[model samples]
Target: MRPQAAGDLVHLSAPASASLRTRPGLVVHRRRNLSMAPPHVVVRRGLTVTRLEQALVDSWPTLPPAERRAPVIRAVNDWLTTSERLAVALESAPKLVDRGALRTLVARLADGCRSPLEIWGHEHVFTGPGMPAFRRQVPMRLGLRTIYLDMFAERERVNIELDGSTTHGDPRQREIDLRRDALLATIGILVVRFAHRRLVHEIDAVRRETLAILATRRPGVIA
Candidate 1:
């Protein structure tokens, strides 16, 4: 329900209740049978709503392409839902129109690619100098808090962090990033951060620097 765009009209599953007298802002979708899967539908505080996974798949066909990418990535990355769960939900959806696009998205999600920026970086910056395979959204536990790296090379302990000014340029976020970098350094993981502009304008340089760093690091040094 949260994924649905803001609207004056409310969309209710038809099976939940019979349609009321003609109303301007209320619309019922007659296609869904919520009774078939009890777990998919929830009744709380007298409101019937579908699970996030179900809602995502059911709403996939209705969304425009760019709008589709963010929600799926956000659900998996920020919400901590597994890509496999999303994939399974997608598989069960009979009316999915963008099957090819969704399959590619699911595969990238499973590989821990969280955003369009990260995906673009993977294709451009990381692929050219590929000695060690980099893992996306690598998790690291630092004391009580857990931090995720944008890209990580397990054998060489090389971590590449992509920073967008809007996301990481704030003072608070910069401080947090510094602390995380310090923690990563303490564990002998080499950290390289590239600004969004660097990746956009200086990709060739970024690729060369990345390959050089990997070349210097000893093989088989586990993080």
Candidate 2:
């Protein structure tokens, strides 16, 4: 139980035998059995609730198709869960309306994308532009700190970072990001960052910019 934020409802898990009556300020979930392993369900402060991964899967059906990828990616990145667990949860849960789409998203998560924008960029830029395969979540050691780039082309020393509000909003984090960017620049890595809105709405411009950068970074490389 992460500290409950204000206006957060109590998510109570009950047996299937329990009554289905809805109560104010309490969201009840009925389960047939309670044999989940660790990380699926957790007991904190004497309350049992689904873990982040399970909660993301449970809420998959409620979201529109375009909105599903972000939550799943965020859950995997935040909770350190794997695509295998997400696959199993999706298999068992009946709420997933688009199973294939969810599985694709799980695959994207396995590929190192932490948000919907990265997925779109990967699919659009990597494949459509016939660019060489790029690595996702590329970890680099900068002294004692480890920074993960959203996508990296090792040969070209190019890195693409996706900035979402939740992840990069804090002033401290912003300063840290700037320092990291400077360090990468010193090593001849071309770091390109895109905001969430720009990536979603102005993808064509993003694609053009990426292709131009890649072309200049590695002359005659993209065929």
The local distance difference test score of each candidate is: 0.76, 0.75
What is the Cα-based lDDT of residue 104 in candidate 1? 80
Counting only residues 3 or more apart in sequence or on different chains, how many pairs clash (N, Cα, C under 3 Å) in candidate 2? 0
Candidate 2 per-residue lDDT, tens place, 54-158, comes to 777766665556666766776677766778788787777765577778878888887877767678777765557447688999889877888888889887789
lDDT of 1: 0.76
Relative to the true structure, candidate 1 reaches a TM of: 0.79
* Error in Å for residue 41 of model 1: 2.1
Best by lDDT: 1
lDDT: worst 10-residue window of model 1 = 13-22
Poorly placed runs, candidate 1 (over 4 Å)? 1-9, 13-37, 128-131, 220-223
